[model samples]
Target: MGRRAVFDDPALRLANNLLDVGRADLHRRIVAALHDSPLEESYVGDVQDQLAAVVTDQRVAERDRREASRLIGIGDDLLAAIGRSGTVLMVWRRSPQQVDHPGQNMPLARYESDGIYQGSWGDIETFESSPELRTLAEALNWAQRRAPHVIVRPWWNDDTHYWAGDGPPPDGMDALPDHHR
Candidate 1:
């Protein structure tokens, strides 16, 4: 065999932009970029211009740049996958019951035509459920279009060890929604 390829290749990583920063810096970068981008002019006639302006405005108190970056990251990952391969397989994390360290332990949800299907390693059964696109531009466009759905609900607190009351009952105990509290 010839020389084996190593894992940590420089070409593998996406260069830093507004996506790499913390919330405060991301908000600042977004505002600066908005001022310098075509969106400034095009936003005048755009339907969602007001909402975009709020996100891009430096004066906004709670800009929510973290959620913005997260949605953008999804598009970025899709693009990267398309760049490497013609198609990409996407997975969403679904947990009926809130669990600590969700990424490593939670079941994966694959979107299907009818509904979402969830399966875990230990379970022999798979749960089915309902839900996209092919091209990189289309993928990115789809992500951007769905960006508004990226609502950052407070799920858990590492400090207090508390999970959102809306989550499934832990240890099979009844858990009521916070709104009812």
Candidate 2:
């Protein structure tokens, strides 16, 4: 009898199917899918790097394998969440040093329909008819109810970089929005 081929594994085949998805589309799909997962802003970079390494090296270290597995699980969850219809509040920061304009960054909060990315202070821009406006407002409400002060500062907890929802924001941050404060 012939030995079983590695490609014969069902899980590997599923992963290969997911891997075949276009990079940008895959990311967008996953973000949209994982609307309710814990937001770990920093994991974005590390997970991308680790997953890349795993794909390139068949003999990757156990740590890389574990991280890749964890990310795959996240992707699976994200895929499962697709079309479920919900919100994911995103927050991010763009420092003046990062952009050409000086003193341009005022507040940092951004989102698509189903994901939230939050970080340091930055310019806030959104279309007048942006559908995510409601989601952003909801996140703000959640932050206020959860953390009455220091509304926008990012922090880390349980090895995840969470902002405004996981816990109280850092000290001295103006709780009110730009116009309000």
lDDT of 2 by residue, 42-131 (tens): 333544443555555555445545655655455443323222212223342332235457777644323233244242211111101112
Best by TM-score: 2
Candidate 2: pairs in clash: 88-114, 88-115, 89-116, 90-116, 90-117, 91-117, 91-118
* Clashes, model 1: 5
Q: State, as a TM-score between 0 and 1, how close model 1 is to the true structure.
A: 0.16
TM per prediction:
0.16, 0.22
Candidate 2 wrong stretches, greater than 4 Å: 1-42, 61-67, 75-181
List, residue by residue over 40-125, the lDDT tens digit for candidate 1: 22322231232344356564345343334333433333323222211112222233557677576544433222222221111111
lDDT of each: 0.27, 0.34
Stretches of candidate 1 above 4 Å error? 1-55, 79-181
